[model samples]
Target: MATKLGKQTYQPDNPPFIISTGTVAGPFEGQGPLKDYFDHVYTDTLAGERSFENAEKEMMANACFTCLQKVNVTPQEVDFYLAGDLLNQIISAGFCALELNIPFLGIYGACSTSAEGLALAAMLVDGGFAKLVLASTSSHNSSAERQYRYPTEYGVHRKPTAQWTVTGAGAALVAGYGAGPRITTFTVGKVVDQGIKDPMNLGAAMAPAAAATMVQHFADTGRGPEYYDLIVTGDLGKFGRELAVITCASKGGFDLSKNYNDCGLMIYDTEKQDVHAGASGCASSALVVYGYLYRKMLAGELKKILLVATGALHSVTSFQQGASIPAIAHAVSIEME
Candidate 1:
């Protein structure tokens, strides 16, 4: 049985939930200035023939399958599947489900899908509707750019603050009951509108959302940044990270300048001109959390972590309309026993 730690009431019939396992990356590699940013790289001849969409599908499927194997759960044991991707129709998630042959609940949260999926999965378990749940998110640079912006061959100049879409995937298994890390709290975010209307400069567009959600998370939980070992933001790049620090300082009366880190900044050594200021995209936050930070937790290097997944909720159509870019963020706090 899962015990409720906080003052909030848990329904008597709520199912116990735990993230039993997870996996990341895939069997396809791309060489660019930012090649070294990824933790796992797949280099093989067969990967060359597949389109970006197909590669993304395979990556997501591999991640979910590996996660299931780690938790000793079969496809049939999963009661609900919630997933998302950066593609137009969430093609990767849809195709991955087809291969796994599991019932699915697709989601669209731009880059915040990982937390979004986790929150939803936790809810189902908490509602006693599921015993086993799987949630995941994936993104590929080539596919995302072609579908959302421009083609890779176009060679358009990007702003210095623009984030590099991560070519990776991350998945996790949330079970009804377990001794692993649990979802302690999910800070639901309000859409923060800073009225920035620049498609090329996503950092500016997303900074306010990150700040708003970070502040809200601290307030909702009645905890400060010192309560956690690490404070991580999803895909906010270097510029956005700075902005977030400043904004958070103003609102929370805490200087997060030294303690704050961005997944985008951690993914690559931008100083090497490999990827300018690291990685972005939906997979950026997921991979960093599941691959890098999760390992640290397992090693007892980190006990608590606050993860804020940020997203720019603007489409090409919305950009053309000169609509102010609205952004949303979701925060999830994880602690290792």
Candidate 2:
């Protein structure tokens, strides 16, 4: 059963465990700091596929397959599979689900899809409705760029605040009983719009939402910054991470100086990669959490951590209509015992 801690948070009595994970990275990400941590890395963005969209589907499918193979669980034995991506109608996830042939639930939270899927999977397992659930998400730089912004063929000049969409996918298998990090709590965030209308400045649009969710998680669980070994945000990049720290202190009076970091900053070398702000996409936090952080927890490096995955909820149509970006963040607390 799941206990309602407050309006925005829930605590599961029989916490679900993340038994296994698989992360697949593209060439650019393979060249980053955590290159050696990823389960699989492709040499190119196309990945030997006909199009970038097909390549994304391939990556997502490979991630799920790797996750299942690691635990020796077949697709037929899985209870449910939840996934999402940045493509139109979540085509990447839809196609991958079709291939898996498992009971599927497609979700969309932009880049927050990773945490959102995990949260829902935890609830289903804790409620005894499911024995095993797989949560996953994917994003491609070329696919996202052509849909959300300018096409890569145009060679458009990117702004200093712009972030690079990660070209990768990540998947994790969650079960009711397992020898791995347990998902203890989850915090759902509200849609927050700070009136920032720049499509290029995703960090500025999402910072307030990340702060709101993080502060609420602390309040609901009756814990402070010292409770967790690490506090990480999804894809806030460098600018939004700084803004999130300042916003948390000013609004909630909670200082996040000691143990806070952003997945975007950890995924790439901002100086050498020419990534202006940092990485942003469904895979930004997904790869780091499923690949690096999860392994670190297993190795006894980190006991507890809070993952806050943030997303900007604006479509190309909305941006073209002069609408401001509305962002949201979802938090999940994972602990190893």
Q: Best by lDDT, which number?
A: 2
- TM-score of candidate 1 to 2 decimals: 0.89
Model 1: residues with Cα > 4 Å off, grouped in runs? 1-18, 26-40, 44-49
Q: After the best TM-score superposition of candidate 2, give how far the Cα of residue 115 lies from its true spot, in angstroms.
A: 0.4
Q: Candidate 2's C-alpha lDDT? A: 0.96
Instruction: TM-score each candidate.
Output: 0.89, 0.99
Q: Give the lDDT of residue 290 in candidate 2.
A: 98
For model 2 the local lDDT of residue 250 reads 94
Model 2 earns a TM-score of 0.99
Query: Which residue pairs come into collision in candidate 1?
Result: 16-176, 33-274
Per-residue lDDT, model 2, residue 324, is 99
Judging by TM-score against the true structure, name the best candidate.
Answer: 2
Model 1 per-residue lDDT at 331: 81
